[model samples]
Target chain A: MKSQGGDPDEELVVRVGRGDPAAIQALMARKLPRMLQLARRMLDDAIEAEDVTQELFLRAWKQAPSWQPGVARFDTWLHRVAVNLCYDRLRRRRETLMAEPPEQADLGPAPDRGLQARDTGRRVEAALAALPDRQREAVVLCHYQELSNIDAAALMSVSVEALESLLSRARRALRAALADMRE
Target chain B: MGMMDRTRFEALAEAFGGRIDLWPDAEREAAWRFVAEQGETARALLADAASLDEQLQELRPPQPSAALRQAILDAAPRLRAGRSRLWRWLTGAGLGAGLAAACAAGVLAGAVSTGPSADATADALMAASDDGAALGPVESLGSVDTESNS
Candidate 1:
């Protein structure tokens, strides 16, 4: 379905297109955190995620001048760019066959026997990181980013039904992996 | 829309958690109706899914570090005062005029550059102003050195 009108970033983007310094700052404030979170979750690496976010904004500045509104929402378009960059990094990692494995979350019993709130959060992060790439993307987009199924599916270039399948598998695996947290 | 069947309701709850609001727009009304009709059974079906959602919420997103924010802001596009005025006038004149003006600014910037670093900054600006030229690498433009323009 077509996204409804009135993208909040529309006016600010136009200003940025014209090289308005204040608008540039405002767009950074509004979008930086979101882009960071999306990258951090998708890549499961803080440093690499920051790199992706920076690159995303650089591209944003270039695209702004030629930006055609009413074609697609700016935020959605940004998400697509961020997602593609993450995919590129992932592909590179696979091609290189990096010596160190991706970090694994400690799923064993909590050392304290009772998990702290912080520990629970860590465990969840580990579980999420452990998910397959596409599954992780599905969960991150739908559960964390809270993009609509339609938007997320479109960004992933999959049908809505396929996106649901990814979500179901991801959530089920998470439910199993973090089962003790529920207790 | 017809009321959601129990099977479909369970499937959606499993995939999208227990929040009807998060369900696809097309299914929300049916899901709500099913909830109203099913009552306890609906709550029972949602219990595990809701618990999972609650646990998932525990994973908070990391905050962007100040250094990262500053680095990104540093790389952002800047419009030099002189160039902005020139661009406005040229654009008002026409496309051909704009292109000619951009070439003039490139010449002026290059003339002002005496050192390698200064030359690189001029090159970056030229690329930025030229719609046809692809953007240079992010590292090259990270610090635009706007003082040179002044």
Candidate 2:
């Protein structure tokens, strides 16, 4: 609903790519928080998710100097990094169906909010994590990442058609997974 | 339109992409055109499709982690170190190799000087000449009595 990763953001990315530290800070100020949130959703573990976010930003800083335009959006690249890292962690899991972080690591407590939005948010997070990896990434990019379909498709390295399919399956899976939870 | 199978419905679902909610003008016009002329069958399909789009939008993602903000920031230094360390090691290795090559050259030079080669032979000849007696005949030959006989 709001403007995100738009033209001005692209200019920031281009500046950062030119070896500007201030640009890095600016980029962090804008993108880091959202990147962290997205990573958390994908990884389902706050600490690891944060690591992914940091890694993603660090990569952007390192890669900024040589970034080329017309390939994809900067935010798309960041989301791709976050999602790919999640998949890597998922594949490396041993003796665990999911990444069950200890309760101590529970991202502290959530901010106080209305029960409906908060509960819906919680169920949504769990449902997202429960999804098969790709579907989760697809849905996260579509809904939470708030990327355009074309950009999301580019990030996923798939055609628009393929992305459509991914989103479709993802939505269906989410609906099925959260069936018991009343939205 | 009448009774598309699950696969066709899934295809429609994928194509629609919940665009019904957004109502992009061209797409809406196209959908309208298709639904307008067609019988009740097409209308029914469009209606079902619209409902599906609403359902898709209802599935929401949650708020990210509480510590997630901190976690990402904390990792920045480590990531920086990772990138910087690589260049540091490369530079250090390059300097080390250069020093190693210089030491190797010094050792080779030392060996050559101490070696029993033609240089030692030349040194021996120079020492004989230094004593002056070894060059006595040759030196006098330049000032021989041939000048007095002429």
Candidate 3:
């Protein structure tokens, strides 16, 4: 679904369509980091994330020239593309690794438990990585990407109630997985 | 806005975390009102959820590498001079042949009119031809329909 109005990226996108060098550079500066982070969190693989980022830009360059404003915000469109690319890669991984079980978060107590910031961070990332795709996506979009719940729901093609349910379940699992950290 | 009950407030806290700002727009005011009425109780309800939110905050987003930035910037589409129908036709009919045809036309026009000398006309045509040559790659890139997946 398209955004209502006041898309901040609209002018830059139109300039990009015209192959404006300054606009392209500006857009990269603004969007690359966000897209990269999104891909990294979604895939949990840095190399694959970079690949997805490259592919996302290639599509953006193609879409720019023909882009129609108000149909959908440029940022929303880019997120959709990035999300779909991640899904494709995830699907491929599942197909090839069908015999292997999905990685589970190590919820067991750690022997050398250091509640250092870095260790806590790693544990959180692991917990996130261990979530099912839909739950992880819901958390990433609403929490990490900071997209509005409505926008995230539309992106996931789920109702807002369904999105809320996913978020609740994801948070519950994460809280359980990292329960040891709180103590 | 309806008054937020304890059950509803707890549910929102679970879904959106402890921060009222993260709650859905429709629910935030009511949620805040509930907090105002039952401060410590509301805070207690959100404490666990807030702890998880804090843990999630530990994983900062990674910065993009310089190499990836350079690669994507290098592949960006470049600006080219506008391609009119006549110019499109010229380029469509092979660059060398197109320049030759344009040069011949320029010579004929120069000979017939009281304009610049044929040498000057040919020089101008050659310059335009060189410009088009410089933009060939950009033009080709623009013409490609990426939707085909070829």
Candidate 4:
């Protein structure tokens, strides 16, 4: 029986709990893209993002059997795990680059997009990388991953107003950083 | 909700960017009302908000490589199997070791309960040693008393 705001993954998680391989595959298919997107945006490293995403699923497999339904949405739990993993890596990274700028992922180019578009994309990436860690995280969760502000706030373990303030500051900084591009 | 004045309107735009629809539902109506009443001024603010949002689109996350996908798929079943195997190994080893310990304890208990006493065995060993000493040396096994040997 579905509750008022039941997770659609409840049934799939149940099946996964039963050791269903197909269910694992289905869950991966459903979750991997967004998880990968979140990690890539947050970490800016394809390999590390893949590592985080892969680990997320591995943990999902381990947790499925004991997963309690209706406690929290599986997707939410999964995102929390992902964001925490990103934070762990970020913390480790901060030690080495205390004064240096955050490293950018080697995004290269898309064949379909023109040179100008590629240049704008690179500038955007650089600007995003230049953001303060918490602000960047808020933007990634809210704008890039398209999570609701409420959910993003929950994931960040901050109040909604705090989350909004983070987003506001992040947007302002981004606009200022990219102001030259608009002209 | 009160009518969206200039300060509130700009704050909303700054917080939520240009997308009026993307604003939280609680403020959406007031935002829309403000946008409708203020006309070009509000529209200009929205335009400013949309600028960064537009550039952000250029930073689209790249699709995961095919190799990465395959690697994850390959790892999934292995990880699953590894968990089960580890569980089985731990439990199996524990049970096996426990059963072996129990059997050893049983055998020891059985020996203590049903077999000759330690004192008797020690005395018998001492007597045999005494007999061997009386027989002079181990090199003269044939010289042992036949009746004693019997």
Q: Against the true structure, whose TM-score is highest? A: 3
Clashes by residue pair, model 2: A17-A64, A17-A65
lDDT of 1 by residue, B1-150 (tens): 987889999989999998889989899999989989999888888887999999988878789998887787677666433443335334545545548576666756765664367757665655545333323322444333232222
Kindly indicate the candidate among 2 and 4 with the higher lDDT: 4
Per residue, candidate 4 scores C-alpha lDDT tens digits across B65-143 of 7776666655443222212222223334544545644654564465566658966644443443333222222122222
In order, what DockQ does each candidate have? 0.30, 0.05, 0.30, 0.15
**Model 4 per-residue lDDT at B20:** 88
The CA lDDT at A64 in model 2 is 69
Interface RMSD of each: 5.4, 25.4, 6.7, 21.4
Per-model CA lDDT versus the true structure: 0.78, 0.55, 0.79, 0.71
lDDT of 3: 0.79
Q: Compose the digit string of candidate 4's lDDT tens values, residues A1-183.
A: 222288889988876765444565677778888889888778766777888887887788778888888878888888899999988888867765666655754332223222343478777876777689899999998888777777888889899889889999998898887888896
lDDT of model 2 at residue A163? 74
Q: Which of 1 and 4 is the better model by DockQ?
A: 1
> What DockQ would candidate 3 receive versus the native complex?
0.30
Model 3 residue A46 lDDT? 81
- Model 1 chain A scores worst on lDDT over the 10 consecutive residues at A105-114
DockQ of 1: 0.30
In model 1, which residue pairs have backbone atoms overlapping below 3 Å?
none
Model 4, position B1: C-alpha lDDT score: 81
